[model samples]
Target: MKAWALLGAPKNQWPSNIKAKLLAAKKSKDLIIGVDRGALLLEELGLTADLAVGDFDSLQKDELERIESKVSDIRYSLPEKDLTDSELIMRCAFCDYQVSHLAILGATGGRLDHFMSNLLMVLKPEFNPFAEKIELIDQQNSIKFYNAGKHTIYQIPDYNYFGVVTLTAVQHLNIAGAKYSLADFNGDYPISFSSNEFLSEKKPLELSLKKGTVAVIQSKDIDRFQNI
Candidate 1:
């Protein structure tokens, strides 16, 4: 798969494992997009964005200049625009490069509004086509969406728990190979099955849905939450 990385500005420090993952993706020919101060953060980590984009109000003039000097391509939006810098990155990624698979970093532990916006953006009409290809990733968890279909989820060595949440009403949802197994579950609104663990460390989790879309999250232990 062609991977794309999008970085945002968050209050928490970026995790080392995720940094390594981004580097691996870069080595595999994935492109990176950095928004505002995220561009500076990428430069600090010895990485350069293929495209650096944002309103850039948060960055000082010298910082912006530094990013401009290093990034191969850059675009600026008006500070008063409707979309957040993160959304701008996603828009350009899809329109300019037809990005299909994307990994997002620095999306959590920031302003609550920004964090919630990042999570819900995938459900927007403009994002529906790429829903399954987008993921919100951090050191503690990786979140992905799926439309009605049979799917298999693998255990991430870094995470010990998983959750399945209905973004909308779902019908006939079934899950297996987890601590809690559900069969023929139906719900009228968004529902969350949280803090579940793999049945066996060696096997993958199985899930199927006859109708509706869902979000799946593989997360580290709660005690490790601080690290995120």
Candidate 2:
């Protein structure tokens, strides 16, 4: 499967520790697309992008010129829009790039509303089906939402902590191979049932769902994402 990552509004929001992971993904992926301010992060990281997207609203003139010169596609969006820059770029990737899996960075830490909106974006009908594949990753936690199905989650080495949360209403949930265990679980609003630590370094946690979609998050150190 192919992987792609988009960086958005990185500025002071970039996590120093996650830079290595970003670099590794860039080398392992088919393409890296930067959205608006994310282009700046790509440049700052000294990584060239295969594609760039945005109105160039958040970037300076020289930066914009530099990016446009390197990438084959520099798709632009209107400054005024119902969609955020990240959402716009994601739409582009789903259409043109046809990437099977996507991870987004520079998406958290800036604004509470923005962060939650981004997290909750996966709840959209158009986006939910891709949740099992589309992930939001940072230095600390890698989060994604999945619909009613069984999923085998592997270790990132960096993210050894695993948790499953009910985004909507879910029942008959089964969780195994963690510090805390659950069986035939039922969850409601504001209730996150399965938050467990990965005790077995050699094995991964297995999540089996019988009903609704869940928010799965894996973290090495949750605190790493604290300041954003």
Candidate 3:
């Protein structure tokens, strides 16, 4: 099964066609897990959350009550817990639901700390095994994780730019089928290879890494940057 974890980023940061996305997911019978105010967003969209998970500190009493009344399955966490709400939701998706793919939405354009936590969580040992199955998405960008291996990435429609960034010290890395190709690139620390485009949409971008984790981001040019 596939699952979608909706986070609590500001509504303005949500994708313009979020409703359509959710509707499609629903049609495919994907599990929808809402985190914190994300549950509220689903409710507002006239959608039902399969499960709700979060401390919900961002929601007012009435709002929390509303979600409690609507959603049947909820896992409440303490605000002082060791794991972030996003992490908890991911764990539930992979371990409990046994989802083969997990798409995360509303993870960006919030507090920088929160965004970083969501982006880097897949690097953790507990989550690393599923890195390739996870994706973080927003209005303008789609971020997917990769481990040490040769992988093929197909171009995403409407996204003109592609980027690769190391999450840790990386060994020999190679990128091909892109405007700016790389051969045997090595880095001791995190670095970004940005603004690279696919040479042809019909061709798949190839990536090979000997060690460490990397995130490949596909993005489109937007008229104005959303506030972070």
How do all models score by TM-score?
0.88, 0.83, 0.96
Q: Per-residue lDDT for 128-190 in model 3, tens only?
A: 999999999888899999999999999998788999999999998999989999999899999
Clashing pairs in 1: none
RMSD to truth, every model = 2.5, 3.1, 1.8
* Candidate 3: pairs in clash: none
> On residues 52-149, what C-alpha lDDT tens digit does candidate 1 reach at each position?
88877888999998888889889898878887776777788887888767778888777778877877777777876677888888657789988788
**Candidate 2 TM-score, true structure as reference:** 0.83
Residue-by-residue lDDT tens digits, candidate 2, 78-181: 87877766666667777667888777777776777878777777777766776777787665677877788787777677566777788877888888877888
Error of 1 at 28 (Å): 2.4
Q: Which is the leading candidate under lDDT?
A: 3
Order the numbered candidates by lDDT, best leading: 3, 1, 2
- Count of clashes in candidate 1: 0
Provide the overall lDDT of each model, using Cα atoms, as 2-decimal numbers: 0.80, 0.73, 0.90
RMSD of 3: 1.8
Off by over 4 Å in 3: 224-228
Separately for all candidates shown, the number of backbone clashes (residues 3 or more apart, or on different chains) is 0, 0, 0
